[model samples]
Target: MEQDNRTAYFYLFGDNEDFGMKSCWIRNLTKAPEEIEVKLMEKGIPPMLTKEFCKFPEGQESLNKKNLEIVWMEEGDGAALLENGEILCVIPSWGGDRGFCGYARDCNGQGGFAWELSEDNEIRKRINNAISFIKEWNEEVNPFQSLQPQILDYYEDIFGESEKYYAIDNSDWPPKGLYVYEGTEKIVFATVAVSLRPQPKVEMYYEDASKVNRIELGIILKSGLTNDEINNIASLISGITAIPWDYITFVAEGHTVEFETIASEKFKYAVLTNKLKLLPEMNVPAFGNSHTNFLWIVPVSDKEWKMMKESGSKVILDKLDTIGEEIFSLERQEVV
Candidate 1:
């Protein structure tokens, strides 16, 4: 579909002289590197590498690197060759404040999309991935959706087949949903497709590298909980997985969130962690060049929450190690 340039304001009009650019979000738009360069050159805007994201644009470090390909978008960020053999470019902006990421066809582009030619095949791959991500988002498609079956297979291999699955379709925000694996001793409430789409801008809130990787949330409990309790657990995990998209941010290890209601009265806050202690080691399945991680949601008391906010998830986890690993016990005592 042809897009009206008006979709983008603060654009380079028929002629411009400010020597600056502005951007608007885009949908179903793409231009070849040379085409972008020629368009800019027609206006005498050389596609030179004027702005270098030495650290990569503000949010580049944590974007869906796998999808946006932030890693291969390296320094000495190359230029998009223009009609004059150059194109002005700002490298690696998809991981920026905006959810869209790719080559900003308009120079004044999607929040900040970027791409240029590079001899290095790795950089080429990164640029290609970024372009693909933006296109997918614009067309309202998720390339990761194909990973669902693979995700299910992974869970079954590690956690055993689920007794039941809830929210199996994308009627809600996230296509991924919750799975219940009933065991002789305990029931595992885990998310399967949550990891299919990596959480947005995770590095901004977390120093731990693991948070950036795709992750699935899990909650384990002793068997024999009432059906009402089972439903509550399933609903909670399903919602928690969508928190990143819900809040337009991310939740990582060492992060804590208070809930008005949860599975128990003693716990009002959830302390998320990946450094498991009592639960069995969950080996995640590899997808393409990467692997997903499993993060367990451990319920905590107000006092424990305070300690976690003060020190980190470590303090709370260590205490659990000493006091007890009762994360599954809905009626357990407060650790603090």
Candidate 2:
């Protein structure tokens, strides 16, 4: 037999209705769709979509049906069973080219939206899956439609009506909207779309990775700060939301970020914390999977950051509390 190097590598993230979102490489299924031949298996398929198969698993991921077993055909080709546990008859994808792509099955909507994008009006005959799964998405098939509203609702439920909701579509349609909630003494700003995907090495953060794999960042500001200060905070929150995806790492409690020679030079660094003194009710998880953890960004000075690294964020928190230092204020006194 000749060497067949074609292999579809995939990684599953976030389960919805027992269906998972998957990312794959080896071929771009969106630009070129291919179906695999059916093959009956004597046994069931193992969990193929894992972090092990997808090291440094970056983008190229999307929604996928979960727990369905697969049967492999000759020459690196495979077939995924539908919810009914039957294989759909399909053509041989490995014949023409010896490469891989995203996984999809005609039944149960195994593949995410990207595979569906390729099944345009012209190639309807070649594809068997229905596009009904994308009803929540916009006409352009935006995936964030279903996820963003949950965060919006969460903020509204806890913080009441936002005086001004600032969102940008530059990166994603709901590019981490900063919901501005006004209070008599303090102001709150919570980000909306940061948890659309899981973080890298999130498993190390908690035993239940699903519960802690995702996060939403927030910062409460003291009342009477200048408009420019508030806007600077908004810009900072929006930028921080992209850090995980942009850097492929997870931000959790105790994580600290230092600002460069940026505009908001009042506070040089920040520490991630969950102890929201203003809105005690806002510290809960915001999603069905319990994946949305809220981390408050408490800014610190250079000396304070050095002290925090030496003693820890908890000690810093205690030191700040002892001095009656207001953590929500950008112009607050340094505790170092």
Best candidate according to TM-score: 1
lDDT of 1: 0.53
Candidate 1: TM-score?
0.61
For all predicted structures, in order, the TM-scores are 0.61, 0.56
Candidate 2 TM-score, C-alpha based: 0.56
- State the lDDT of candidate 2 residue by residue for 216-317, as single tens digits: 777776777677767777777777776665554568888898643243466788888775444344554343334577788888888888888998888777
Candidate 2 has an lDDT of: 0.52
Each model's RMSD to truth, in Å? Answer: 11.1, 13.5
Worst 10 residues of 2 by lDDT: 88-97
The lDDT for every candidate, in the order shown, is: 0.53, 0.52
